[model samples]
Target: METSKVIVEHIFLLVIVTLFSVLQNAFFAVKLEREGKGGNATAFERVSCAVRNCMDAYPTFLAVMWCAGLCVSQGPAAFAGILYLVVRQKYFVGYMGQTSQSTPGFMFGKRPIFFLILMCMVGILNYLLGHFYGRCYKAQLETLTSVVAALLLIP
Candidate 1:
């Protein structure tokens, strides 16, 4: 598939995921209110914080996803985006339950973002190297770059 098509599909998926997160947060708030826990300001605070965290990270995530999609590979970029959605969902559920339970999901959610950032850095490096050293090194650098990107997924 063409890169633009792939990127658009990824963006669509991101939008759906974002909506789900928002809905999930709203569900928590409604449930808390029904249970009469809403009177406890901390309960509302926790839910709002969770939702706010997602909102805070979203723009940066979108930017990084776009950079990876344009500069690296669409498949990997989309994979990272989907992974973000999954981990963020996990995080929301856990945070709603207990703060301690949220750590694992929060930590895992960061991995894909870090990988995306690394991919962007590598892409810039590759471009610069290709330009300065000529085409002779471009193929080798591309291979090396892919290897490094793949290694980021390892435990």
Candidate 2:
């Protein structure tokens, strides 16, 4: 059983996931604004689509994780919690497209390009395994999350 505080932290991780997704959509809004000749409405409209989807999915995602945490305790499930927060930040930056010679910092940060390959790979695996295995207590599901947690722990 995950402690009450840790479960609270776990919920914070979910918020972090949503925040990163919002950051990505905000970056897209910057692009949208540029494309729209600096029209704020157009930028808001463009970014809202992705933002809405993530917001809508949060409750279901959290509910599933609640079950997983209740079943196996926090240690195993927090593994995915960590993964979601880290990789989504990377994916957010990557999705904003390339930066180069002339303009910079669509959101006021400098970063290397294509550095998210590993982050993305791990994130995808983490997401699928979490979604599939985090909702149940079957042997196979436990085996899968266990394997994934082990793999994540390796240097």
Candidate 3:
């Protein structure tokens, strides 16, 4: 697919995911508020905590996603973004259900962010080396990306 197309698609998906998250949080807040009226303060606190946790990570997700997309590859960046969001939603749901059950999703979600960060660094390095020294590391990058894809099962 074309780079522009991939970036557009990635942004579109991000918007959708962001909207869904907003709606979900609103619903949860209302539900938790109602529960709080019935003297279930814990539910309200749980929802608040869950929302807070997700919000805390949102900026980092956006930064790494854009960096990787612009610098590295849009397709892989979009794929990693999807993976992160999916696992993040799972983490949110699990946290609301049972805090302990959120561990796996929380851990898994970080992997994509880490991968994106790695990609961003690699992309920057590739640009620098190529521009400054006229040394192309395209093959090295391909090899590294292949290894990472295999490790992350990003097919």
Candidate 4:
């Protein structure tokens, strides 16, 4: 497949993941109101924490997703992205039930993200080594960097 096609496919997957994240937040908000907890700041605290955690992780997730898709392996990258969405959903739901029950979900979500980060770091190091070894890594690195920048710039 062409590089652009691959990138587009990965972007679509990322969008789906993003939509799921939004849905999770919406679910929590509805739950809060339905349970008469909307007025309870403490009741909203867990949901808020979950939403904030997602927000904090999102940018890194995008960067790693793109880097892995372009430089590492698109299939694995996409799988990891989907896995993140699944585990994150699990985390959100588990946290809604009980804070203690969220630990497994948190670990599941975190491990895939950690792996993706490792993949991104390895991909970058490989590109750097190729550059040092006189290969044409600069163009690829620039392309990846540009894509990441564009993604980050998106609201």
lDDT of each: 0.69, 0.44, 0.75, 0.67
Question: What lDDT is reached at residue 7 by model 2?
Answer: 63
The stretch of ten residues in a row with the least summed lDDT in candidate 2 is 106-115
- Number of clashing pairs, model 1? 0
What's the C-alpha lDDT at position 19 in model 3? Answer: 63
If ranked by lDDT, best first, what sequence of candidates would result?
Answer: 3, 1, 4, 2
Give the candidates in order of TM-score, highest first. 3, 1, 4, 2
* Model 4 misplacement above 4 A: 1-37, 134-155
> Model 2's lDDT to the true fold?
0.44
Instruction: Compose the digit string of candidate 2's lDDT tens values, residues 59-152.
Output: 5444544445434433444455455434434433443342231132212111111112222333445556678887433445456555655564
Q: How close is candidate 3 to the true structure, as a TM-score?
A: 0.74
What is candidate 1's lDDT per residue for 57-116, written digit by digit as tens? 978887887676556655566667777777887887788778888898899889889888
For candidate 4, the C-alpha RMSD (Å) to the true structure equals: 8.5
Alpha-carbon TM-score of each model against the true structure: 0.68, 0.40, 0.74, 0.66
Model 3: per-residue lDDT, tens digit, 1-155?
A: 69989667646645554566567657656756776787767776776788788888988888887787766666567667777877887887888888998898898887889998998899999999999999878667756665675566542
Residues 1-155, model 4: lDDT tens digits: 69988668756655665566567667766765654555766657776776667668877877787676667656566667777777777777787777888887787777667767766886778778877885645456545544543342122
